[model samples]
Target: MGILTDTTHLHITTWVVAVILFLVAAFMQRDSKGRKIVHMVLRLFYVLIIITGLALFIEWSSSDPMTYGIKFLLGLLTIGMMEMVLIRSKKQKPVTMFWALFVLFLLATMFIGFMLPVGLDFF
Candidate 1:
């Protein structure tokens, strides 16, 4: 539990794993073997991501409320985009827009996340 003792590590590890799972699920063929299982695991990571992310925000938001709030909102939107992509994909509809939005949110979130701990005031 040494590394887990650091909230940053916990948050980052789960975040990376969640994204990896997402990429895997996204590329897998429709109704392919293990698709549901991969998605279920990905969902669990989403929960962990929310929990750990909230904890980080609770601690860090005091320092920069604006950035934290934006990050939190972006996180929510990222998840929403992920769900939208999945739903649209399942319905055999176009998810190109949703996927683009998801990537943008993910990049923004990570950029701000790395900057936050260092007290960077780019915003």
Candidate 2:
């Protein structure tokens, strides 16, 4: 397959890993060691997601400055909210709001991808 197709596949796989990590980090109530391990794994997954996402973005439509700019801003906001959720207070409400924002951004990204003729030209 082409590089774009391969990259798309990898991107989807990385997202799946990210989702698993999110669930583990959000729901798992284990010992300190286990929690640490989960946190480490989630951090690594986040890095991979960012890297692959950038690669995919470059491959898809680097020619469109506006789309790229929007994507970059949204990505930064998503990551920032996730970091806040992880490191801010132990309070549940703020954490829930962060996760909710993360999910909303994720869904927004998917919707944009589906509706726009940009990434992968899949539609």
Candidate 3:
């Protein structure tokens, strides 16, 4: 419990980094080698984000399972939307819808995360 006692910073850091990487990868030329590298790095951040998020959830969710559960699901949906947007963009398909959903879900997830007991309480 010691190491995992407070994973909030790690979780938030992962999300921030993942978002930046995703944006960078998404805007790069589809066939560029640098885009491929950034995409791979973004994938790694995805894994790190999931791991840190799960750690925080497991550590603090007992206090309010329902809200935490919703936040968790929203987080997953946000991640899925991000990946879908990137994939569709790379395939030269229309990504406007996925981009919209990604923004929606990401904002919702952030709101919930901030409202949680262990969260920033900014909202």
Candidate 4:
């Protein structure tokens, strides 16, 4: 497989891209054309994040199933929060809670990813 298809590479890259797109979508003006485009792109990023995350989880779950399990659930929660924020923003509703949860889950996911024995020097 080429470098792009590598699970670890894809996982990290997608996470970063997803976060960036999430922020853009979150901050865009309500009901604006730009916001719509950004939100659509953000949805694609979410899909990439899930796919790459699950690939990594399956690879690492054997040795540390407990950690991976928690991370997996957190990942899902993070994605859900992302979607919630978008919906709330589109409706012009307050997204404070959803934003908080999104940040929390995103950070937790990164913390776990960083601590894993991936042997990468990203830090």
Candidate 5:
């Protein structure tokens, strides 16, 4: 588990890249092939984020399962909201609610992650 000895950094990096990709895809023309390619890449990053997040959760759950569990769920919801917004937008549907939820969940997940024991000591 040497490579996964520190999944925190890997998880953060994946999510950050995912967010950037999401933004890029969101702003692109819905009918463009480039947007579709970026969306696919973003989905790959989503898998990476989930894997690294689960690794960290498994390693840190014993200390405070409740908080870690909450963060885990929030992270998943954030990802779901991101996907929903993109899909809806591509379908020419209104996604104002999904966009708001995506931002809210992302912020909450990040705040909790930074406050966790294994996370950065920013707070």
Candidate 6:
């Protein structure tokens, strides 16, 4: 496979992992230690995904600012929502809104990835 194809595969995998983490983190029972562990592992996976994504971006030297900008914004929103969820999870506060928006952001990321023209590079 070509380098671009390989990078695309990795990017898709990262997003898939992120989606799984979001679902697990959002819906798992709060009192379960196993759930907590799972959430932690998912968080770690997300961090890895983000780091790998950055490395890929740098390696590719993407030049399409619009796609990159959208992705960065979505990433920030996702992280912010996750932090909110974590903070409220301990307090048993309703976090449905956060989760809902997080999911939407994930979808938006996927949409941007799919809709953007190939070879439209970003820094």
- Predicted candidate 3 versus true structure: per-residue lDDT over 5-109, tens digit per residue: 464777888899999999998899998999889888988988888877888888889999989899999999999998998888888999999999999999999
Q: Tell me each candidate's TM-score.
A: 0.87, 0.73, 0.95, 0.87, 0.97, 0.75
Q: Rate the local accuracy (lDDT) of all candidates.
A: 0.81, 0.65, 0.88, 0.81, 0.93, 0.67
Error of 6 at 122 (Å): 20
Query: Candidate 6 at 27: error in angstroms?
Result: 2.2
Residue pairs in candidate 3 whose N, alpha carbon or C atoms collide under 3 angstroms:
none
lDDT of 2 by residue, 24-95 (tens): 666655445675687788778778767776766666655675676576567656666766666543344457
- Output the better candidate (2/4) by TM-score: 4
Candidate 4 lDDT tens digits, 10-120? 778887887888888888788889988988888888888887777777766788888888887998899899999999888879999999999999889778777776526
Better of 2 and 5 by TM-score: 5
- Give the per-residue lDDT of model 6 (tens digit) for 1-123: 245344566666765776677667667777788767877877776686677666655554366766766776786677678767865886799888987887788677666666555423452
The regions of model 2 sitting more than 4 angstroms off are 1-6, 89-93, 116-123
Error of 6 at 39 (Å): 1.4
Model 3 lowest lDDT segment of ten: 1-10
Residues 49-110 of candidate 1: C-alpha lDDT, one tens digit per residue: 88888887877688899998998899888988887887678678999999999999998987
The collision pairs in model 4 are none
lDDT of 4 at 54: 76
Q: Which regions of candidate 3 fall more than 4 Å away from where they truly are? A: none
* Model 4: lDDT of residue 107: 89
Ranking by lDDT: 5, 3, 1, 4, 6, 2
